[model samples]
Target: MEMLCEIHPLHEWRGLLSQLVKMAFSIFSIIGTLPIVIVFGLYFIITINSYLKTKNLSTIFFSLSFLATTLTYTVWGLRVFLLPQYDPHISNLLPYWTSAYLFASLSLIFLDFACIELSGIENKRIKQIIYSIILITYSILVAILFIGFEVEITTFMDVSDLSISNIFVYAYFILLLLFYLTLPNIVFINYIRTSILKTSLTYKKVRTIEMGLSLFTIGTILDGARFPSNIGILIARILIMIGGLIMLIGFTFKPRAKED
Candidate 1:
């Protein structure tokens, strides 16, 4: 006996239409995000140019990270749309894409933290060594995640497929959440609370950085909830968008010295 597979026309049509809509949204979202990414890219480059003139290694690293993030995400979104067919090779892209943005975010945090420590800490070399160790450790972990990791992606309207390495990726983020999100925040927050300053631009910059980090943390939590809670994701996206806009505005109004 031959077994017959029956296809429901309405169900098939709905699935096709849902996929089409998702593709359209992906395209539009990428387009919308590009200008903001470019603006940040330009600011980062300009900051790096200035840093290069001054031999400031810190800013140079931060700028490079941001550039990497811009390039990686741009490629990521395009790759997904162009090759909508699910393939195992697509999973390999996760590590590089994840590392780029993670590095970028950390670089910015380092720049700010380094700046704060410059005023308070007497041993500059020690600070450098500590930061180097932290970065190296983070790099090694991301490398581990790149080879085989669990990832979840929604192909149709409500269904998602989980890749093989979910536990590892989750563990990786837990480390990141502790080191990058929690520890630095507490250190910086304490530094801000105790430090005394008289209208220094550095103080203002630190405050801005803190606010930016807070928003990113909130946004990450919201993103994590997207699968189980779409409404939460929407709220989180809005918070992140606002935070990004604020950071962009700060760059535009960055302090400049008066002509002599």
Candidate 2:
């Protein structure tokens, strides 16, 4: 993120309508979505420790997911809203490499681990091995992301436009991201298919989890896209806000199968 010094100045939005749309995007993302994400993250961290004392470590991973998500929204807000005008303040707020992409990498790592814990795999040994492998792999990949930012290999636009200097490296990251994001979706699908609905209450509980996961996944996808207009940005921010809300709702349900 720091290496991205090249600013491709977009065309001027001199019209009142254009300015209004830009203001809407900025306001929704910064004022509306950002606070919601932060609150959701804090709720998970505090709630898990206070009341929901389940053995499942998935709770911790979910909390970390929210934290990373909060950072992502924070950095995006800074880049889009502040960096163009207040570049100096951004450096004080975050490290040079601490971009939305870096937060995304962290989120995927934790979310994948959470999914593995929630996948109903009862074998402790298998789970240990899987976790060890994931830790080692993410250590390397996250290091590379930092180095890429430091050396300017993976520069990003202020408006969240990802600029790829090395196709091979970018592809590698993309493939891993696809896998990480897909794994939870697949797990959620299986749960929806085979989850024993002993009653209407249980069925509703599972459906809520499924819906929350779906919304969060979709919002994450939209967050990464290159927005051509402010309307698109506003829509994405709104999705993120709603996604954060339902994600917490799903976590509150806490169906069985996940183990610490």
Candidate 3:
């Protein structure tokens, strides 16, 4: 008699597609969420650029982060539309690069912006060194996973296996969830605390970004973790959409340029 096959969660096409779509839009929603992440990222860069009269430390950090976010979102979006031609196995690599490097890069940049713009952490060298170490460690870990594995990069594993490799993949995803949940909130919380003493509209703009970040970050965690409930992914997509709208509102309040 033939043995019954075991199905893995990753192999569940409908479920996988649903989750990926949530994440894809969550990332791409930056276009809509421009107020929070894109607005703040660019606003800080430009403000710092003008204020400092040259590309100073904050400018460099925000600029690199902006580029990384753009790259990550662009690649991820393209992967979604181009999945048919490329092997499905390669799709997992998207998170490896996008979520691991790009998201982490964005987080560090957000931290730098928060520290300078909010926390008053003026030690640029310390921030740079810390961010650098983080990027390097993340890079090394990704490289190890890519190089040391016996599994083929193009081979899609059966979702049923729930094997060591699959579990490792999910484990990395959980790690990302933790980062996504903690980092933005911490930055926002600190911003809120610091703003209490400053009494400035700058903090208002920062608060807008915080709201957007909170929504997206929470959405990412819920979707990234692949919670058992079918509704988790759906909720994530809703949060992403909401976050994007909140982010777009930030541009309306930008410091208007004096008519030249």
Give the per-residue lDDT of model 3 (tens digit) for 1-260.
Answer: 12324455446877778765654454333333343344445544554454466535544554454445444445534444444323446445544443434454454445445434443446789657655755665675566555553333431111110112465754764564465356546756776886664445556666776687678667666655545544555576467546645643542245545421
Model 1 TM-score (2 dp):
0.65
Scored against the true structure, residue 98 in model 2 reaches a CA lDDT of 51
> Can you rank all candidates by TM-score, best first?
2, 1, 3
Q: Where does candidate 1 stray beyond 4 Å?
A: 1-36, 52-55, 85-120, 149-169, 224-231, 248-260
- Compared with the true structure, the alpha-carbon lDDT of candidate 1 equals 0.54
Candidate 2 clashing pairs?
A: none
**Could you give candidate 1's per-residue lDDT for residues 12-79 as a string of tens digits?**
88888877666546543444445546755675677677677766554564456446545544554554
Give one digit per residue, the lDDT tens place, for model 2 in 116-221: 6655667899778777866776777768766753223222322323345576776766676666677777766776688775344444544665576677677666
Which has the better TM-score: candidate 1, or candidate 3?
1
Number of the top-ranking candidate, with lDDT as the measure: 2
Candidate 2 lDDT (Cα, 0 to 1): 0.61
lDDT of 3: 0.50
